[model samples]
Target: MLNKFTTKIVSLSTLNNYSFIIPTYQRPYVWGEEQIKKLLDDVLLSFTTNKESIYYISTFLTKEVGDKAELIDGQQRFTTLWLIALVLSEMTSNNSEISTFLKKGDELRLSFEIRDEIKNYLKALLKKESTSKFLNEHFIKKHPYLENIAEALSTIKGYFLQLSEDYNLNEFGNYIYTNVKLVKNTTPTNTDLNKLFTTINSAGIQLEQTDIIKARLLNLIKDEKIKFSRIWESCENMNNYFERNVRQAFPNWKSFNFKKPFDFNDNLFQHNEDVIVTNPKDIFSIDDLLEHDYETVNINTDIKSNQTEEINENEVYCRSIINFSQLLLHTYRIHLFKEGKTDFPEEFHSKNCIAIFNEMIKRNNTEEIKRFFKLLWKVRFVFDIYIIKWVTNIENKTEQLELMNINSNTDGYYSRTKYEPSSNLMLQSMLYFTGDYLRQYWLTPYLNYLLQDFDNVAPTNNSHLEYLEKMDNIISTRGGKSEKELSFEYLKTNEFTQQRLDIEYFNMHLGTGFKHYWFQKLEYILWKNWKDREEKNFKNYRITSRNSVEHIYPQNPENRIQHPEIENKHLHCFGNLVLLSVAQNSEYSNKSVSVKKSMFGEKKHTYDTLKSFYIFQSNQWTPKEIEEHKSEMINLLKMHYEKTFF
Candidate 1:
């Protein structure tokens, strides 16, 4: 069986039924901040460097017993990249070349089930059915956050448009279509890309079983022979169990780890005062259960597998996390269902997940699933921490003790639980301990909560109790903030997770720190600000586009740019260039830079303070001047820091 094939980049209209299979058991789509930033940066860079439409195709192999490729990896990268494409489409839809690609891409691609899934997901994300709708839905005309991202992409797209004005994009597209490149593997071979992706992403996080369940659900969604109703019902017990027991009864419980144990304090419930912790049985309507149409969800057993082989452990781990996420979601749904509300869907948003996975399922681009895994891993522990705190708080409660004394040693609170490592390797043990304690901290209490609803009976059906001893062993080694700090450290070292974080924290916040870098890189403002080349005059005005932090003050003169411009003597002083936008700074042109500061009252001081700080920090400043300005800079920074931190 061949796992690799190479093909040319063809017209969007030509690629038909060449399914992009994301396995049901693949990890959920997630991208770290940095990886996302890099991807966006790459696209932007490409617009500056690569002239023709650059197409890249990545491929992966599954060890699972199927040909259907569930998005085991690369979901976030795909989604974000697609988003960039969408933005490009919107920007150039008016221009013939870009419009041709955008409209054609939409028309040709979105008709595919996978593409529709992505479109619907994007709509949900944008909170609008269409791009035009997004433009109108908000009072600001264009949502600033989204608009910033779009503009970055739009600028790059425009750069390309101008570059290709003479060359026909359609002609280039035709040439590329005729000569596609694939991974070029004939027999099944594990691509190093997938392996590297798995290693980089698998550090602190492991995919969950719930991810697998969602994959199964998606498979069911695509199956025609099996009624969706039957599939729904088959999953009802599982769904209802999660919802009633987890999402609603324990609103904070989202992930499953067996080490960090949980304990339920039922006595905390006060008939006259406190919130009632209801049972799963009470929450799920019996009428709905009895009348629930299972006929709609039964997926065909013989449904074609997009996967051609068995999925490896990495793939399994990935799918499991997605399944786990769905489980949390269902649990939340159950919470809502208890209140007689239909707040969310039951199908696990398969279309959206699948679509994202499809766009990102490439050999070199496993960053998406890696992100999902990290979050899945982090969230699991976060929930665990919450449960532990919840249980500890309950045990110490005076009101609860009046009803029952449920300490950590009590039946539901199994303090005597044993521990065993699945692997004896030190690293493995640490991972186990980390995962186990974290799991116990959250899962045990969840079970206890369920048991409390069933007359304080401990969990008999759940696997959690059986593993209590192993959890106990791992918990013995549990340290304080050390464990959490270590987890974060592990995450930081993880390339995929880190990259996804960059996208989340940096690229997404482009108007924040990221745009500053852009301004520096482009140097558009320096040209506009400085007009004269100098040597003889020794002009009191200092002019330099040395890529220094945009300073508010001039170097040579102590008088601020805010002081009235005194002709050539005070030209290009600190006040004029300090608060200028990047473009303005570039435009000042080093010529006569004499400009008076605006009398904006309090705002002026803020600008002055900021400008003063920059000047003080300049490496070129004399030691004496730096010392003089240090306290002022410190004060300004201190004030800002206090407000930000405290």
Candidate 2:
């Protein structure tokens, strides 16, 4: 097994000796700010903890094509690494070590096959002195295919700029070049590359850490291993509802009754009827667990047909905010907190979850392992019912945060209705965008709240919305507070202490430096209090993953003579800025105020930020209007804060 493939661990610095090609069949660069930020942050954490220690990135599978290697997998991470090197070169003077991996002489070390424009873009990026100038010149011209690459570059630049002065970039770059390592697994010459790519994408050939954890837990209870495995498999499919997962995984369990979509009872896991075991052997390995797939059984043919047809017509195209690993951590944290343990971690990091759980199970008895899985089932059920998912429309490809209402028919079959934008959705979207993308701290407290006496809690009551509103207030005004101070226990007993909202303080921050929280929070405020005739404009509005801040009045107006009265002081203040997606921000680049105003009106959907809609609604954008709008927006935030929390 080990003779045919050549495998070796190589550092970023050693990659300077090799060239790679991204085949045309590969997807375009699709890593967004969330992904780029997570990779950089993970590396930075390793660098800070111990610069001398080696940080092992994942493996890369490639085939040797002449002197160049064709990337079969790991293209996204590889492209991101190259972009990091590019950003580091631009920001610092002594970047020879980093630049060597980016290029060899005049030729780039990485190239896209048959993508001439992308190749030219990469070359131009190397020659330009500043990434910002290159992005402005090329991205503003509307290369729709390269938007992800451009957005990634922009995110990398901003991430480095915001680092504290104490952290030396030169040292960090040196660490990245020398200490960060990836395993390179090169395929043999006779291997069929096409079949390899298809197999890698369509199937899971390698065992994950989660699978090992499941194996370890199941090994503890030999008598109930089948039951535990079913629980684990059901919880793993985060995209589907828990009721459906349970039905599919435990098809032979006749006592199970999904009376409602959110009905999760502890007794539901007991084997009231005899369950057919496909593999009855007592000694099963991790590979056996990984290979096992549950056989689907139709409960009611008539209801199942109707459900299938309805789902196919209006498919709920949605993605979970957190993955299965993070879900495990969330469920585990709640478990420990309920047991009156205080040593658990406050933040969720997927890299650390395995080690944390290993330590946890080390101290647990067999009974404890069974209890954990039972709790996981319940937590996942409540999660699907109460949390917001990134739901997209099939026809338009436009996405919004949606809390879907689960509907049940007379035969007790469950289906989901189309989502309508509500306060619960808006509030969660605000938190989702404003907080750390990798670690959702808000979920710990919110999920814990829903799980309390969960069997008795009504999913239709307004209590869920009220609890989220209070949590938002606490999170918003939590200025420099520690996580311990904002724990679930603290949320249960505390009311928000009103803080003075300073208009002048907010006015001082300018440009991209302005906090995005204010802009997003204002959108929620506007939507809640909206009574205007333009109700259609905002009725369907929801917060999205926005990072770029756009200036309503162009900083360098394309037609310079249009709005000269706006002074530098009022130019970049809160009133002039709106949080927008990267594509929308580039599309409105440097246009005159009137041109921007016209573009806003022509669009059928609502503005990304409702504040922008109101700002552009004015007849003119002079200094006087900026000052008045600034004051008015601040007053709205101030009043809303006071009313909601105090």
Candidate 3:
């Protein structure tokens, strides 16, 4: 029966030929704005980055029932794609595209089992009978699952609307319809559907390529394999600090202290020579590790002990921006750059990590492999201290990108001190939100910068901040340079200079089509130079992941007569636009400028960008006010550019 299963790769256009049905046992649609936006952005990026490239979205496991295919997996992604088709159909206003691609005559290509409300809601949206207000009021409240679909629809619509000015909508729509693809795996009819579903749901996570690489590398090192494996495990635990990971990994070792939390030295695992260490029972050799099936192997049994340090419940949870695979790639890039290899790839994708390292291993010696692992340890130490993490606030449960300064007490216990937000955190947060969430290109060069003087002494917070600010300017102004070229330039020279911003060349009226980076960058500049009596209002401000570009003077206001003085041409301009979260954008939807200002005043803390707050400071929004605000903001940006780049 397993041999009878069939699989084929199909483009979105080809996928449209078959109809799909979600089983009654399937989970409800749970993807929110973040997931939906990511899909939209990823597809858009694929189209823009390489239009000819066939982007494989994901694999879908299904079982054929008569003419319809029952989706066993990949429903979330497929549903999102269907919603995208709906959005494109509405934008183009061509029912044929929908009929041919997403629907069979008037019937949707996809349907839910025992879920009529959702099916009806989708039909209403397709027929143009559903409005944003209608979704919020009627269907969403009754059918809770519809909320995600509604939000997804809004997110898709808003994403396209925002990028309309910058991208070719027709071309993008066509690319999504034709270029995007999925792999469909059809199970045999004889297969037990219930058993298959149970197995899939109860399955454990598959072994990562990193795990394979670890095994392969450890097989080569006859001596100190356990110690190196421990080091690799410590670096893999990115959530906790490096020192804490080291302590957890080496539980029996007493008197452990890093020169500093940020600094790494050779004596990290070295303990008192007088202490007798007992090796764990039944240790497996590299050959045994390589030959055994990872699923059946009890790899943790050797390390597991009752004396192991328990995790502290009160400790702040900090999430690393990049995963272990990405960190390994970054560390490997730095290692190659240091070894006088200038052609290493700058872009990072976890899927390609094994291949990237495989090429490296084939060319380098076993000793070099050991060195790479050691460098990974050192890199992670600096990364934890210097990088901005999504630190969770215990009380509010809100996460913010923060770089907490580590303070060591006289007794050698490290505590995270609440340091005031510095330019380092602000600039990193700005770069973080502005760049690709998956491919953080800035870290490669920035991590290399930290590694340059790492052995002598760790850099002070002020100097580190200055270096990052300069890197930010270079990244912002490096108009057409490839990421590899930019990384090489950053590595090869001390003088980091790039193209300067020409204020005249920038379209102040780009509105939704404007690059989000500029808005986020301006926010950083405003926050850095803030000195108003309302300092308390602006002090806690940090740039977050915001996709919606809001207009101060609403494009379609509820009260039409509220802002008649504002001209249509100035409505989408930089002066009127501010980057905001999707929820906030929905909250401020189509309100009058005065009402929006009143809403801003009502909040105790201002979550809006400082630039937006500045605009709201004016009582009435008029063409005169817009022009005045535009001039001031442009000058501010230009001045900062000059100060940083010149």
Candidate 4:
């Protein structure tokens, strides 16, 4: 049956016989960061470790539809492979073979048999047009597959930026074209994919791709096999490697060896309170105004790029090491996502990278391995720098650099706003949402904003605080649906737990980080107005990890005289909550309301927030007061929504 019709191992380069088409049954392009990275890692490993001159990725099951072949089971991999090919084509401009398949647009076609709106949406992306209005106004509601396409596009472009110039990109491109092979499988006459879906679903996965990736990465180190293997295994608890000092050490990426293990005791990296320790020699080379030029001030200042690198001189080397991983999703998000939200798969994001050993015994030439590692490290470095200080890769030709003049001037925090969000406000907002507990409603829009404004060559008209406004509209107008309700509506997850909820209760149901997110956003918005008039210790008031929801009415009533207002009912509700430091919460825990107010005065710096400051106006503690405070806070939230959307 396999031989009767047609089957051939076709390299992506010389392939031109049949056009590939994605059917409507393929649904949304759901290959997320995990799937995307896994595919890239798998292919890279195959190239680096496998000895096969032609590495067959998988078989594409299809039946001919006119001149084009209707893709049945292989749509996801095909889409990803095509995107990777496009990236490589740009990387290797001189190579005609890599670009030919794509330049001849008919070779890879999108035949959305059911969802017609998506055809245009994809065309817009390919044309490099501003898809915001189409995405916002029509496609979102009209096309069900919109989210997947948007995500895939965002993920691909973001990863492409991570490819640094240290690698032989041209050669890698050639490898992708000349070596990445696929088998074309065909059945008889034209048939609806919906009818064939059951048969395709039963077909098993062909390759254990990630396992191969592990063998390849580990194979980098030939010496100190046992020691490094142990370290690699332990590190494989799986996390992205964070080499903070490599920016300084390897000013050039072409030379870093993935195989050579770094000693944890080495003074190269000094992690001080989860921050990368940088020296005078690390960041600056400026010779002008505001101490340093704009170019010298790292794109991402959240790393304390401009601040003094004052850390423990006699610091222990125990907590400073970062183990490298094949799945660099964290760094990938850092590059692409303005507010890196967590939704990536656990194994893809969490596990340690397995290095290629002998079964990994595949044979990639030294130059190929070196080049692959260069791409890997480039992705890591670009993403790390993006998260810390938004710097584009100077070596990456794909990174379109801005023509700028930085001779003497240097005071662009992108800071200093009057009422609206300045460049600093947007930048801060992006830095702000890097927590794991962000809601999907907000994550979707936030990713959209970053891809549009931050990654663009020039900022757009609606690219400022208005972007925040649009995002707020997107999130706040989750149509007052609860997480369960929204999940059911969109994701088709109709569990027994799913129920209806109003906006107020929905607010209560938000994640801890998301609650903190809003409280901090409000704090910053109000702080900008209050920054003037010389407020003591309040000038630098920004959200810290220590700032937590402080229950004014304590969770547990004291052993002493109990108050009716401080009941178990009100303890966990938003009515009793305000932002306070961990130290302050501990200090005021179970204390009388009057005593807590007195402590609040002493620790005024902690209570500098408008939300907390509003609480101080009422001296007494009663159920009525708590209810009123809750009402006021709710109004503030409403006001924030009003300001953002309208």
Give the winner by lDDT.
Answer: 3
Tens digit of per-residue lDDT, candidate 1, span 186-304: 22334333433343343232233434443444343333212222222222222111112232222222332223322322232112213232111212221222234322222222212
lDDT of 2 at 261: 35
Q: In terms of TM-score, which candidate is strongest?
A: 3
TM-score of 1: 0.24
> CA shift at 529, candidate 2, in angstroms?
1.8
Q: Write the per-residue lDDT of candidate 3 for residues 1-646, one digit (tens) a residue.
A: 3336778888767765578899988999998765776677667767877888777789888888666799988899999888888887777665324335678656888999988778888877767774644455454767778877777777787778867776767677778777888888888776666666655554434567887788777777767776777778778867777666676566543455454444334564643333223222244432333244344433232233234564545556688888898898888888887777755552356767777777766764777878888888778877877788888888899777888666565745465645577777888888887876666778888888787654434333667767777777776787677555676568765656767886864545676778778888898888778877356777767777777888888888888666564565688778888888766777788889888888888878755778778898897788888888988999988888787766
Q: After superposition, how far is residue 157 of candidate 3 from its true place, in Å?
A: 3.4
Q: Estimate each model's TM-score.
A: 0.24, 0.84, 0.86, 0.36
In candidate 2, what are the lDDT values of residues 500-581, reduced to their tens digit?
5555667784666666777888888887777773577676566777767788888888786775756678887887888887
Candidates ranked, most accurate by TM-score first: 3, 2, 4, 1
Candidate order by lDDT, decreasing, is 3, 2, 4, 1
Error of 1 at 449 (Å): 69
Cα-based RMSD of the predictions, in order?
22.4, 5.6, 5.2, 25.4
List candidate 3 segments past 4 Å from native: 1-4, 37-49, 92-100, 114-117, 130-133, 136-144, 162-166, 188-198, 219-223, 252-254, 258-307, 345-347, 407-418, 453-460, 505-507, 532-536
